[model samples]
Target: MSLCLKSITAVFLTFAGTFSAVSVAQAQGANVVTTNFNTVDEAINALGTSTYQTINTGYTETSKATFTFAVPSETLTLRYRTDNTGVALRDDTGALIARFNAGDRTASEAELMAFLRDRYAKDTEALKLKVANTPSDPVAGNPASLMSQMVSASFSNGTDVGPSPLTGGDRARGTASYNHLGISLQTGRYSGPGFSANVTSLPLSYAFALDDPRWAVKINAPLNFTTINGQDYVSGSVGVGLRMPVTENWSLTPELRVGAVRDGNSGITAVLANASLMSNYRLDLKNGYGLVFGNGLTYSKSLNSSGTSYGLSNTINKNGIELSGPFQHQLYGLPTNWQFSVVHTVVGGTPTYIDEWTDVSLSLGTIGSKNGVTWDSVRIGLTYTRANRGVEGLNINFGYEF
Candidate 1:
């Protein structure tokens, strides 16, 4: 038994040596296979129909035909696209092998493979550099928090001039007796953890008083534009308000607003709605001037089709206080109307929207006839805002109350 086992072991060793030699020779021969064809088409024809298999026709919009051939060691694939200029080759593992250009077929197979490898390396390095240089999006907070902030910025009160919320102050006197038209432009800076961005807005407004002068109607529309990580986004709102006098010095306005925000790059849309109540108290002063104090309370809600809860809550409550003083002044031997205003946010607990904000504004104007048209008032104003955990802004305003 021992002798028979020794003979079997010797036979096994000889067979293993012969098999190793044959494998090495086959690998060398595979590398020596001719790659001298001038075009990829010529190479595919050399493989012979019996040796290669067709995988598919019209594999993709760009790739029209696909075929594969096996050598002694591994498999190689060739793909033909719609255009005649080039074809792509891949290894068995689906890794890019080479891109064969029919028009410029000067490079041999080894040289072409080397060139592709170098190009791939350079392209990968370039991509890494680009990502490092590009700025990230100024995300205010989580997706929900961002959505809430956008709604608050675009649909919140004070975006436009209206009839009697007088939340800031009355427009020029006798201004309510006729139609009031105005435009406001503002640029804001928003800051949050690790990010910041600039936001711009334009608002147009119209208002009219009823025959009783105690009742009024107001309409406001505003467009807000912002860019995040080089992508553009737009938000807009439309609001309607009704003013009802509560007493001699107090008034109330109820407002309803509908708003939308769209992302230009992703084509995502968010819709929001707001309901608000605004009130004002006037302290009559001497000579057609007065000091006014007011407050506004608003509830905002938003939703998107993507099923993401983009709002902090279905109902976010916000409130703020406003003060204004309007007085008469002499400019160039004529009486001019001048006003100054200040607004501050005062909400309880952690603010879902604007945690802390303050705004100050000044305006100058006159009421008279011009260009044969009776003018109630023509005014221009400037505003500056300071805020924390929200947005700070500078504004320019124009109005024609007639």
Candidate 2:
């Protein structure tokens, strides 16, 4: 069946509307105060004899361009001393919003962003509607951007770029506000268990933008080693997908995947063809926190003409929904980025089962001084998946960005 552009457009609009509920948080009339302390030692040294704390400006540069982290406001500086109470955030009316005691794990830099967002994110429908309006459309026939949205999409492209909910990873597609974001390259690896016992997946992925930054693509191969009952086996799959922003705040990604699952004991390979469609709505929350809500559908068809297929099922449909909430803050003074996410998926037609994957990561990037000053973004993270019908999986990932 051919893809329907109109239906896709409608879906995009609908998704965009769903986020209208997020309120546009307003910063009160406070003057922002920034003190440069590049490292923890520096910050610690300055506070040698006193307890001084101020709500630092929410965050700094994100992959997104010119996006406001939070409105500048006078920081509430407090002095910290041994046996001193923790800090508290308050609204204009002096209503207590949240409090963080010293040494509280929930008071980490990442959670600070969440606190700011919870306090300042939009509230009223009227304001949210106003913020949701798309900017005046760019001139017609203009050249596509080489780096604006593309940077966010390509560098942060999810590991599971294919349609199947089984392998889909992060959902950090770039914003739709502009033609392109920035241009960058990224490579990564992942190793984890699969549906059955003794099946390990080691996949390598590379992601980059096409000629136009508005279009980003990812190519990945899932290399697998399976030990069924006793015998050893090997298999892999190749997947390619592209991200296209339909608007300044929404995008579309369609992927094609092909792979074979080799069973060691049975000595049979299950060939599969999978097609997937994904959409994302980029949301900017208070502070430096960003949220992306995505949904996707994958159709898998078995190529076994002989009817009896391999251990892997032949035909099934998978539906998935994802929520990715990432935040940025200064670790000491350097930029620190982290994300938390949950993905729940359901299968239809046959081989009924459910899958849910949750993950978190912390990232740090440095800008080269001379060599074009490209940013090298590196991240390390852990994943935990709890399935209703199969063994759970755990994985670690390391990614580098150019």
Candidate 3:
């Protein structure tokens, strides 16, 4: 029994050695079979009437057919072809698997084959999952069937004029505004999958007063200035947004907005338009610990009339990143839900300046105090999101989502 086992082992070793030597020789001469077909179609036609051709051994001759060959039994099969003239690997299925054509240079067949083999061996399951979870359109979850509108009135007091230097000391000359009356209306739509959109508008009116008689005297002496102590500024904005689920707990949203400022005294107006893209992720925490976080980016531009070119030429660009997470009621019985966010804005193009005494003027072809300015604030508030109500426009008011 020992002698028989030894003879079998020796035979196996000899066969393995011969197979390895043949493989090495084939590997060294594989380039002799290279082709110049740019595409699978060209290669298939060049193969002529031969249904199959043998190239590398062990790989069946029937499996070596060009892309265009018809295999009645197998409905699907993967084919590989290379264009020795260029650095592209053209798959039998017409897909350009890889390209090494970097302008004027061409890659050798061996280099191209190595690249194709590496890519084919990579793990693609994660990439497939990511693509499958991405949404192609907007989706608003849950359907709220209520509609309502809200009107809010507020009072604000501030000064439009700044203090100037007096003979003996610096004094706040000019005027101050007080008891401003402002009204806002929020209209909501509650229908279709748990989705709601709100429209808000605000108009303000104020009373103005002048201070420091000396500063007024100096201005009127040099230039015949008529002090219009009071002025009105009206600002309005409209926004529309919708959210839809791409997966079980992930959603995407797109929003568009337009804002305008009209001076009641000069009847001049400035307009700004913005667009935003946002995504929300829902995290499953324990009861009363569920959190939803989101982030978004915005692009805005300003516009003004041609004749009255405010020195800044009405050019402004801004981009911001924000993050907000909502936590449920846990230890504290506080029914308040909290969210926080920070936004950094980059300002570009021309600056704007408004003189309290004279007409508004454009300066530096850019608008704002600094070329780039960032304004970030955080707030926490409670949320009352209800579903299936029959009002016209009332929904929810919360901070911006990142």
Candidate 4:
């Protein structure tokens, strides 16, 4: 059914008492199809019969059915309920355009038409603004950046010089051999504008002397569970390092790691690789106090990161100082070892990375012989970090070595 332009103008004039400037300026160009409807089905059928193309039709629930129609410049939608009170028009982004009720007469057809046109114009302007404001580079807040953050946290944090062959290897004879096995659990959460990441990892490590007291091979395997933007994923890594003692007090290790994260639903994998050189120096202080100074340089890169739709690459440097000493009093009839460590990241990571964080850790634990072995230790620690890009995190870590 169609309403005449003269009738629409008359109805507006009667209710408004005077034809305002806006009404006068826009009434002439108002689309008559925006006129009031007796029922919502009438509105939906109207668009279906016009230039709008029907995109889909579906029911949200038993009582509500929705129809969506689109054109090149606009998208229109209508939802019809069993009660016929759900007639509403919406833009593509689900912004409400208009709500219609059966036999409504409070507003004139011209007024309804004017409101529809104004809403459409506003929606168009908003779409343009959103497109202009969206970041063109995915690194700012994309999945790739989230994965990069995970990789950085795994490599940079949770690792320590505690009881490692590079730190306190026994040197009785060239044929002296030792074995180290340990596990570490770490979790971190980071957030920034438009995105966030949460990750938990369990890593197992094993080190053994390579037929020489001062030479060792270390292997690390980690299993990771991560969530980014509300989606969950599983990933893991394998790393290997070789220790070469420079002197009685210093050692160096060169390491390589490979990892992958998979999009479980899509079966796409993002691959990562990192190489690092680590140095450790030990000082035996007087009065049972011990000091360990550690430094590391690393390079990391990504492949098959199209799964995240961005590239990941970074260089990082780490320096840490740690002091450990025996407690003056025994705990539970066992001697306690207390440790404090502070690590600083000298170089930052890529965009959206939490690389340049300073970390502080403190712990108290017991060290004693296990079975016939003379060296065994177990510790629980807490770490706090403030990172680049305003990221902050706290973590609980546990370690055991024999």
Candidate 5:
């Protein structure tokens, strides 16, 4: 009788162990919890008492614990049942363990389940360490330490004029404009030993126009007439740049660019080279008032086209200065962001005219004129940016970033 009882006890224990194993497997397979609340805080609160909870305590919980919570190898889905919207986690530094998304309402149940499983498998202790060392607000941290990069593409078309004689006579001239489009791709590394690079390309398009002006000529006067023809212009460039943090609120960047232009009708071609150095300073003012100052110097040189003696036989040089500033909260009842920028270019060396005749010597009476000339120009613009925090591609950009 005693032997029989022992056998029965053993059998009962084996059955109970098998049942427990199956229950654990089922729990692991489906760990997702559904809630009616749209917010993460509300969902967490709605969890029943049966759900497992881990609370952190001082001496026992180290920085590694925080890090584990912050760094997610895969996306973390936060679902708002109230609207069925969701957004993926985008914390790269493992700093934001708890983030609130007001517009994440598009994740499916299957995707959310996969995200949760991947996150659960990460090293929680390591994540905790990272999060503990990170600041509460990533943006409030050192700007120099933040990594940012951008690229843009644009197309513009405009007309150009040709040369003529000083005397009132028809000259050979052509009007041409090309639709120029370019794209740039860039990546940047921030204050902590960062780096960046970009590439740009522009495709060529062609167009032409003609102009005619009639002038009265006296009889017995020397009749000199010329025809003007328009030539299409095509140009493109690619460049790379780097930035280094000089101080807590200042940074310095240096870049180089190379480009070329071709005029098909006139057989005029040239290559362009440019080098620039820039510095930016950030200032924090009262009442959320902030200021940014930027200054830069650029040198550009144009190499003449081969086999062309009249248009540009030699290289030409141009040097310039640029200044810009941004003011925050400068006006009442308006957007807080405002910016102004100006660029001045000083041209040196003999200027090249599209028509070879413009550079040739013309003797009228006792005065003789040569073709080469020099000039300078200044361009200025202003902008206002509206703040749309936590949104991408929703703000307006009027000027170039590079």
Candidate 6:
């Protein structure tokens, strides 16, 4: 008997808790549950003995007015009208009441508000995107290697060897290898065969997508040791960039980098700035194969304060342009893509840190799925930047998507 009584009390308490929760939910809905009715009978029944006043906007005209009651009541003016002949009412040109039936389900005030707010924001953003979509017709739009158990180097003897040598930091952004989170190893040579000076960098980078896959940001701090006339010193530069997808197959990326070599023991020695833009369009080849073509442009300017540490001139300026063609394929396995590119640049003032080298690179990687969520692949590629246009650098990349 004691055990039976205990079970009975437990069940009673459970039911009581459920009922209390239901009452709370009803109170919440009481806010949005204002004046929901499927028929005149329903409305009248809901109103009970509440008094409502109707305002007139010349009933004979096409215009109609509303009837308002008090607070906590629906404010919408859904009242109907009839001709003097006592004709039947019509739903057209008037509000049609909707009745909601949750089938014994209820939500707390917080839940309802959250639901409404989320739906509103999502719908608003969707509408904005739809409106912002271009009216124009649809258009077509790196791996890492070289690392040991410890810190290793990815090198390029001479990279981007062309009419226009690009700065080691020029064209900071690259093709859309969309990854939510990524890290890459990069190496480059900024000086072109056009000049007798040589400037090189080996950088590690981190990339991350913002709230949406369509937007991403990256920050890079390249600390690779620098060699100036055989005098090697640790170099430092920090770069930041963002990428935005303008369409299903087209995107735009912008980047800015500024930093300098510190006094071997004091403070700042030299500084430079690189502002660059990269744009691309992709054409789908179906079955995990596609084509991407792109262009990159950058302006690099620098000031050398170290004077003699490196041969860098007092001032340097260079403009560069790159054209790219990337092939998308399944590689029948983990290799996701292959790319080829060419660059040209024009140099004005000779800045020791700036170079006019043409560059070419090829990469392979893939974005796959594991448990419904997407996972980006490890990308690895080889690049050649030389005064004579030969492979001089190598890059490795790893990324994740959520």
The numbered model that scores best in lDDT is: 4
- Show how many residue pairs clash in every candidate, following the order shown: 0, 26, 30, 0, 36, 32
For model 4, give the RMSD to the true fold. 14.3
- Candidates sorted on TM-score, descending: 4, 1, 2, 6, 5, 3
- The digit string of per-residue lDDT tens for model 5 on 115-153 reads 433343223322222212221111011111100000011
* Model 1, C-alpha of 158: deviation from truth (Å): 7.7
- Evaluate model 2: give its lDDT: 0.36
Where does candidate 5 stray beyond 4 Å?
Answer: 1-231, 304-336, 348-402
TM-score of each: 0.52, 0.45, 0.27, 0.57, 0.27, 0.41
Error of 1 at 147 (Å): 7.7
**What is the C-alpha local distance difference test score of each model?**
0.45, 0.36, 0.25, 0.51, 0.24, 0.32
- Tens digits of per-residue lDDT, candidate 6, 1-402, equal 122111111000001121111010011211311222221122222321121211111223122212321111122222222211111111234454332222211212123223333332323222122112211000000001001100111011012112211211112222334443333444443332222212334444455566775576765555544343234445556667676778876666676666554435323354555565655455656454445454545454444453322221221122222333334556336434443455433333322112234445555444333323434444455555543222233333222222
Which model scores highest in TM-score?
Answer: 4
Instruction: Report lDDT (Cα) of residue 216, candidate 2.
Output: 72
Q: In candidate 3, what are the lDDT values of residues 233-344, reduced to their tens digit? A: 3444444443444665554445455555444444445454545555445554544233434344444444444232222222222121112223443322223223322212
Per-residue lDDT of 39-113 in model 2, one digit per residue for the tens?
222222333112111222222111111111212221222212223334444444455555556463224333444
The residue-level lDDT of candidate 6 at 49 comes to 11
Candidate 2 Cα misplacement greater than 4 A, ranges: 1-200, 227-231, 305-334, 352-375
Output the TM-score of candidate 6.
0.41
Deviation of model 3 at 321, angstroms: 9.6
Give per-residue lDDT, candidate 2, residue 341.
Answer: 52
Model 4 spans > 4 angstroms off: 1-176, 191-196, 265-267, 305-310, 328-334, 346-353, 368-375
